[model samples]
Target: MDRPALLAALRARVGRLERAGAAAALARSQAGVVHLSEDIDAHLPQGGLARAGLHEVLAAEPGAAAGFAAVILGRTGGPVLWIGPDPDAWPSGLVRYGLSPAELVLVRAPRPADGLWAMEEALRCAAVGGALLALSDIDLTAARRLQLAAEAGGALGLLLRPDTEEAGPSAALTRWRVDALAGSGGSAHSLGDPRWQLDLLRGRGSTPRSWTVAWRTTTDRLETEGGTLAAPTRNRRRA
Candidate 1:
């Protein structure tokens, strides 16, 4: 083989080896960490939510996505800093979801830039257990900043983006798309547990997967079995 061709081949081989080494290292690191619940933990590469990482949550239905995030925040036992415009959470409603209104500090930013700033600052606060932000648009640079801040404080950062926004490149540790199911509610008069079709679109050192989960807000419990809708039966007219 020519000298130049031999050198190029060697470089390509080195590059491939480097990529494989990085993937293996990431997998080893993730296997030791487990966050959230058993169902989600089993699917995630990191086992559970990484305490010092950023997680992105998006859904076509805004309410469904918000509920999913709420469940995560509920698992944290410290104060939660929520930043956004016109948060949809009701003080009483949060109780059913395992969040205490007293433990929440809400910050309403007049603009998107201000909101992002608040989120980064909140995530950096050691006293804060988690930071939640509602954003319609975000770039790679901004997302990385949030991730770093969360790592510094060992807090979980949840970014809620609009479904209309495309799932482009992000520095977030995990990206999830939550869709609310029709059977989320119970009877005509009373609302029962909320259910969702949770899609894990992206994760570090993990494959994408989906699940149907039921959340009993009153008890803050997640049930994975017997929540799915039954197949519809086709009726045929008698001849």
Candidate 2:
């Protein structure tokens, strides 16, 4: 082959090798667990929520209950199945959080037990990307079963309960107590107000953390505050 042609062939071969090496490195980087980070890293374990299998959030009040579930479902970005005690009154804010109204499948059960069962089935469906199950109350056994189903389907599960239901054993990967805080509106840079404060209660391989997050319904974004709570505290007595 001509000298110029030989040199060109050699350069192309070197470029291909370099690209292959880069791809290999990228694959290795992604092989491990990947947590989702939405601007607030310090408040979360490793700067993101663990995306491994199952996670739970328990709210201390009705507002917090609905808002926390919405935040978790919003982050999944997949088809969500919400099973509630009553079909008539579904949490409207969930739709505002970017969960498509069409993407959400609401199943209303006459009783809390039936609702839990329906939620388990929904999470088991491969077609379902994620699920948020809101119950008036769920016993420890029911929670454990739901957790198992979530793990099997590789779907994220959130159990929203009243403050009274917080006492019990749970199979959830993590339990978060969420509260709605008064928020101020102004320039975007300043941490306007405390929209929601989340307290992580339990998780394997990770310590608890607290976060101050703002939910902008119009923008469909959850902005993490520049600051987090001073210490992790559990209001189990109240819940």
Q: Report the lDDT tens digits of candidate 1 across residue range 32-147.
A: 34255577777666567877679998865787787778777766655676778766666566666677887676666657877887788667655566779988878999999999
TM-score of 1: 0.77
Best by TM-score: 1
| Candidate 2 lDDT by residue in tens digits, 1-239 | 44355346534543443454454323423432233335444445555654425566666656755765665665554556676766532545456655667556666565676677667765654445567777656667877788778666556677776556435666777777777776656556664433777777776666666777777766666676776555465444532
Which residue runs does candidate 1 get wrong by more than 4 Å?
A: 1-34, 184-186, 226-239
Deviation from native of the Cα of residue 207 in model 2, angstroms: 1.7
Every candidate's lDDT: 0.70, 0.60
Stretches of model 2 off by over 4 angstroms after superposition:
1-47, 88-92, 186-194, 233-239
lDDT of 2: 0.60
Question: What is the number of backbone collisions in each predicted candidate, taken in the order shown?
Answer: 1, 1
Can you give the TM-score per candidate against the true fold?
Answer: 0.77, 0.71
Q: Per-residue error at 225 for model 2, in Å?
A: 2.3
At residue 193, candidate 1 shows an lDDT of 80
